[model samples]
Target: MRSYLFVPGDRPERFGKALAAGADVVILDLEDAVAAPNKAQARDNVRRAVDDGAQVMLRINGAGSQDFIDDLALLHGLPLRGVMLPKAESVGPLGELAEVTDAPVIPLIESALGLWEVMTVARGPGVERLAFGSIDFQVDLGCDGSDEALLHARSRIVLASRVAGLQAPVDGVSVALDDEAVIAAESRRSRALGFAGKLCIHPRQVAVVNAAFSPTREELEWAARVVAACERSAGAAVSVDGAMVDLPVLLRAQNLLAMAG
Candidate 1:
C-alpha cells in the first residue's frame, strides 16, 4: 500500500478513475473536502463506492459529528476495506466504531489532543494503520508545515503504530502538485523517517510516491542475500556479501520479501 489516493465520495465519476490512477488504496472522503450540505450525498456516494468492491475506504466525519453516525449506519453492511476515522483524539470513539463495524479502522490523528492520545488509539482493537494529517496537525500546533515542525509528530505516529503492531504509520499528503521534484524529495524524506506509505493528492504523484516507498533493486538484492545467509546461519548474525547481517538486518529482509510478495 504505497500510494493511497483520496477521491470525493460524492463524485462517482472519479472512483474508477482514482483506482486506475495507480493508487493502492482509494479513500472516498466524506469529511473536510465535502461541504455541509453535501453530507447526505457523500454518505450515499460512499455506500455506492463500497459496493463496487474496490479497495475503498470511507473517511468518515469526526466521531462527535452527526455525519459520522449517519455514515457508519449507512456503511455498516457494505464491504468496505476500511474506514478512516478523522480527528481521532482517543480510543473511545474508535471502540464505539469497532462495536458497530468490523472493517479495519485507519485513524487520522490531527490535533494535539489526538497526538497525545495516539498510543491509546493505537491500542484499540480494529485500527490497522495510523495516518498523520499534516495540514490539520500543523494548524493545531500553530506552526508551518515544514519538515522540522512536523518531524516530532511524524516520529511519534510511527512509534505509536509500531508499539501497537500496526502497519508503519502513513505520511500525510504532499500539498504541492506542480513541484514534482519537491514531492519526490519529501516522499523520500518521509520514507527515510520510517513511514511505509504516503497519501497522494493527484494521480501524477502516485508513481513517485510508490517508487520512493518501494524497496529498490539494490535494496532487494541485499535483502535477498541477507535472507539466504540468515537461513544458512539459522537466523543468527552472519556475513552476507561482505556485510554483517544481524537480527535487525534479518527483519528488514523479511519485510522486503513481504513487500515483494
Candidate 2:
C-alpha cells in the first residue's frame, strides 16, 4: 500500500469519502485527532467502519493511556486488517497490545524513547509496519518541525522496519494542505530515502501522494528491461547492459513492478 489516508475517528461521515479517495488503507484516528470527550464514541464509530470493508486500521491512543484499553476492547473480534499503535515506546507495550487482539499492529514511534527502542519494537510479533509520527516526534526532540529536524528519525524508522523484514515505513503526514508543490517535494524525498508509502491528512492530497510514490512509466520500463536482461543472462548477477544486477537491484525491480500495478 503506497498511500495510507487518515480520517478523524469521531467523523464517521468522512470514512466513505476517504475510501472513495483511493488510499490503500484508511486509518480511523483515535489518538491526537479525537477529543477526550469523544473518545468513547470514536471507538464505537471505528468498530462500524472496520466492519464496512474499508481496509480498516485504528490508531489508538498511547499504550498507557486510559483510552488504549477501551480501544483494544472495541477492536477485539472485529475484522480489522491492523491497528496503528501510536507512541510506541517499547516492545513491552506492543507485546501487551498483541495479547489482547489478533490483528497485525503497525507501530507508530513518536518519542525519543520510542526511537531509542525502535528495533526492539519492530522485531516484536504482530508488527507489520513502522510509521513515523512527525508531529509528536518533533515534540519529543524539542526541535522545530522541519525536514532537517526529521531526517534522522525517518532514517531510523526505515532502518528498523527493514531490520524486522516489515513493510518499509510510511512517511509522516504533510501538514501544508494548500501547498501541493511542497507536498510533492516531500513525497519525492521520502521515496528517494526508501519509504514505501506516505500518510496523508487530506483526501485531496491522496492522489498526489500516490502519484509521487508510484513508479513512473520511465522507471517501470527501466526496471522491466533490467529484469528481462537478468532473465536472459540466465539469472547472472551482471546484465548485458554492463550493470551489476544483484539481489538489491532485483528487489528494486520487483518493487517497481509491484508499484506500477
Candidate 3:
C-alpha cells in the first residue's frame, strides 16, 4: 500500500469516489475532519459504509476518548483493512485493542512522548504499522514543519517500524492540494526517509504519491541488472554501473524487485 487516502466520515457520498480514486487504501476519517457535533453522524456514516462492505480503513480518535470507545463499539463486526489510532502516546490504550477487534492497528506518532516510546507502541497489540502525523507532531513540539525539522521524527518512526517487523512507516500529508509538484516532492522526500507509503488528503494526490513510492522503470532495470550480476558472481566481488555490487547493494536490489512485484 503506497497511498492512504482519507475521506471525511460524514461525507458518505464521497466514499465511493474515494474508493475509485485508486488509492491503495481509503480511510474513513472519524477524527480531526469531523466536528464534535457531527461525530455521531460520522459514526453512523462509517457504520453504513462498512455495513455495505466498503472494505476501507478507518482513522479513529485517540484511545480512551469517548469517540474512540464509540468508534470501537461501532466497529465490532466490520471488515476493514485496518484502524488508525491517532495521538498514540502509550501502550496502555493499545493493550485492549487486540481484544476489541481483529483489525490491524496503525499507531500515528504525532508527539514527543509518542516518538520517544515508538518502539513499544509499534510492538503494542495489533500494531501492524506506524504513521507519522507530521502536522500534529510539529504542533505538539512547537517546531517548524520543514523536512529538516521533521527528519529526526520520521527517521525514528521508520526505525521503530523496521525494528518491530512492521511495514515501513507512512509519511504525513502534504497539505498542498493544488500543487502536484509539491505533493510529489514531499512524497519523494518521505520515500527518501525510508517511508514505504504516504498519507494523502486529496484524491488528486494519490497517483503522485503512488508514483513516488513505486519503483521507477530505471530503478527496476538497475535492480534487474544488479540481481543478474549477483547470480553470476556467487559471493565474489562484482561491479555494476561502475560501482561495486556488494552484498548489501545486492540485497537492496533484490528488495526493490520484490517491492516492484
Candidate 4:
C-alpha cells in the first residue's frame, strides 16, 4: 500500500468519497482528527462503516487513554484490515489487543520515547508494520518539520521495521494541500529512505504519493535490461550499461520487477 489516506471518523458522510480517492488503503481516524465529545459518535460511525464491509484500517486512541479501551470494545467482533495504535510505546498493550481481536496492528511512532523503543514495538505481537507520526514527533523533540530535522527519526523507523522483518515503515502526511510538487518531492525522499508507503491527509495528495512510490517507466526498463543481462550470463559476472552486474545488483533488479507487479 503506497498511499494510506485518512478520513476523519466523525465525518461519515465523507467515507465513501475517501474510499474512492485512489488510495491503496483508507484509514478511519478516531484519534487526532476527532474531538473529545464526538469520539462516541465517531466510533459508531466507524462501526457502521465496518459492518457495512468497507475494507479499511482504524486508528484508535492512545494505548494509555480510556478512549483506547472503548475503541477496543467497539471493535470487539467486527472484521477490519488492521488497527493503528497511536503513540505506541509498549508491547504489553498490543499483546492484550491481539487477545481481543485477530486483526494485525500498525504502531504509530510519534514521541521521542516511542522512537527510542521502536525496535521492541515493531516486534510486538501482530505488528504488520510501523508508521512515523512526524508532526507529533517534531513537537516531542522540539525540532522543525524539515526533512533534515526528521531524517534520523525516519531512518530509525525504517531500520527497526527491517530488523523486525516487518514491511517498510509508512511516512507521515504532507500538510501542503496546494503543493503537489512538494508532496511528490517528499514522497520520493521517503521512498529513497526505504519507506514503503506514505500517509495522506487529503484526497488530492493520493495520486502524487502513489506515483512517487511506484517505479517509473525508465526504472522498469532499466530493471528489465539488468534482468535480461543476468539471465543471459547465467549467474556469471557481467556488465550492464558500464557497471558490473553482481549478486546485489541482480537482486535489486529482481526486487524492482516484483514490486512493479
Candidate 5:
C-alpha cells in the first residue's frame, strides 16, 4: 500500500467519499479525530459502515484510555481489514489487543517510550506494519519538524521494521496540504530511507505520495536492463553503467522490477 488516507469516523457522510478517494487503504479514524463526547457515536458509525460492506481499517484509541476497551468491543465479529493502535508503547498491550480481534495490528510509534520499544512492538504477534507519528514524536521529544531533527527517529523506525521483518514503515503526514512539492520531496526522502508508504491526511496528497514511492520510468528501464544482463551472465559478475552488478545489486534490480509491477 503506497498511500493510507485518514477519514474522521464521526463524519459518516465522508466515509464513502474517502473510500472513493483512490487511496490504497482508508483508515476510519476513531482516536484523535473524534471528540470525547462523540466517541460512542463514531464507533457506531464505523461499525455500521463495515456492516454495510465498506472495507476499511480502524484507528483505535490508545491502550491505556478507557475508550480502548470499548473500541475493541465494537470490533467483535466484524470483518475488519486491520487495526491501527495509536500511541503504541509496548508489546504487552499490543498482545492484549491481538487477543480481541484477528485483524493485523499496525502500531503507530509516536512517543519517546514507543520509539525506544519499537523493535519489540514490531516483532509482536500479528503486527502487519509500523507507522511513524512524526508530529506526536516531535512533541514528545520537544524537537523541530525538520528532516535533520527527525532523521535519527526515522532511521530507527526503518531499522527496527527491517530487523523485525515487517513491511517498511509508513512515514508520517506532511502537514502542508497546499504544497504538493513539499509533499513529493518528503515522500521521496521517506522512500529513499526504506519506507514503502506514507500517511496522507488529505485525498489531494495521495497521488503525489503514490508517484513518489513508485519506480520511475528511467528506474524501471535500468532495472530491466540489469535483470537481463544478470540472467545472461548466469550469476557471474557483470557491469551495469560502470558499476559492478553482484548478488546484492542483482537482487535489488529484481526487487525494483517487482515493485514496479
Candidate 6:
C-alpha cells in the first residue's frame, strides 16, 4: 500500500469519497482527528461503515488511554485490513491487542520515547509495520520539521523496522494541500529514506503520493533490462546498459520491478 489516506471517523459522509480517492487503504481515524465530545459519535460512524462493509483500517487512539480502550471495542468481529496505534512506545500495551483482533498492527512512532523504544515496538506481537508520525515527532522534539532535522529520526525508524523484519515504515503526511510540487517532493523523500508507504491526510494528496512512490518509467525500463541480464547470465557476472550488474544491483532491479507491478 503506497498511500494510507485518513478520514475522520465522525465524517462518515466523506468515507466513500476518500475510498474512491485512489488510495491503497483508507483509515477511519479515532485519534487526533476526533474531538472529545465527538468520540462516541465517531465510534458509531465507524461501526456503520464497518456494517456497510467498507474495506479499511482504523487508527485507534494512543495506547493506555481511555479512548484506546473504547476503540478496541469497536474492532470486535469487524473485517479490517489493519489497525494503527498512535503514540506507540512499548509492546506491553500491544500484548493486549492479541486478544481482540489478528489484523496487522502499525505502531506510529511519534515521540522521543517512541523512537528510542521503536525496536522493541517493532518486535511487538502482531506488529506488521512502523509509521512515522512526523508532525507529532517534531512537536515532541521541539525541532523544526526539516529534512535535515528529522534525518536521524527517520533513519532510526527505517533501521528498526528492517531489523525487526517488518515492512518498510510509512511516512507522515505533507500538509501542503495545494502545492503538488511540495507534496510530491515530500513523498519522494519518504521513499528515499526507505519508507514503503506514506500517511495521507487529504484525498488530494493521494495521487501525488502514489506517483512519487511508484517506480518511474525510466526506472522500470532499467530494471527490466537488468533482470533480463541477470536471468541470461545465470551464475555469471554481467553488464546492463554500461553498468555492472552485480548480485546487489540485480536484486535491486528485481525488487523495483516487483514494486512497480
Give all candidate RMSDs, comma-separated. 1.7, 1.8, 1.2, 0.8, 0.9, 0.9
* Runs with alpha carbons beyond 4 Å of true place in candidate 2: 235-247
Q: Write the per-residue lDDT of candidate 1 for residues 1-84, one digit (tens) a residue.
A: 888899887778888889899888888888988889988988877776666667687788898878877876876677877889
TM-score of 1: 0.94
For model 3 the TM-score comes to 0.97
**Model 2 TM-score (2 dp):** 0.93
Off by over 4 Å in 4: none
lDDT of 2 by residue, 9-100 (tens): 99999988988999888888998889999998988888777776667778888877778778778866877778899888888778777777
For candidate 3, write residues 1-261 as lDDT tens digits. 899999999899899999999999999999999999999999999888888888899999888789888987877877889999999989987876777789998999999999999998999989999999999999999999998899899999999899999988899999899899999899888899899999999999999999999999999999999999988888788999999988889889999999988
Query: How many clashes show up in model 6?
Result: 0
The local distance difference test score of each candidate is: 0.87, 0.86, 0.92, 0.94, 0.92, 0.92
Between prediction 3 and prediction 4, the one with superior lDDT is: 4
Top lDDT model: 4
TM-scores of the candidates are 0.94, 0.93, 0.97, 0.98, 0.98, 0.98
How many Å off is the CA of 172 in candidate 4? 0.6
Clash pairs (backbone) in predicted model 5: none
User: Which stretches in model 3 have alpha-carbon errors above 4 Å?
Assistant: none
- The true-versus-predicted C-alpha distance at residue 46 of model 5, in Å, is 0.6
Candidate 6 global TM-score: 0.98
lDDT of 4 by residue, 1-261 (tens): 899999999999999999999999999999999999999999999999988989999999997788998998987887999899999888988987898888989999999999999999999999999999999999999999998999999999999999999988899989989799999999999999999999999999999999999999988898999999989998788999999988889888888899899
Ranked by lDDT, the better of candidates 3 and 5 is: 5
Instruction: Provide the global lDDT of candidate 2 against the true structure.
Output: 0.86
Q: Candidate 4, residue 227: CA error in Å?
A: 0.9
How much RMSD separates candidate 5 from the native structure? 0.9
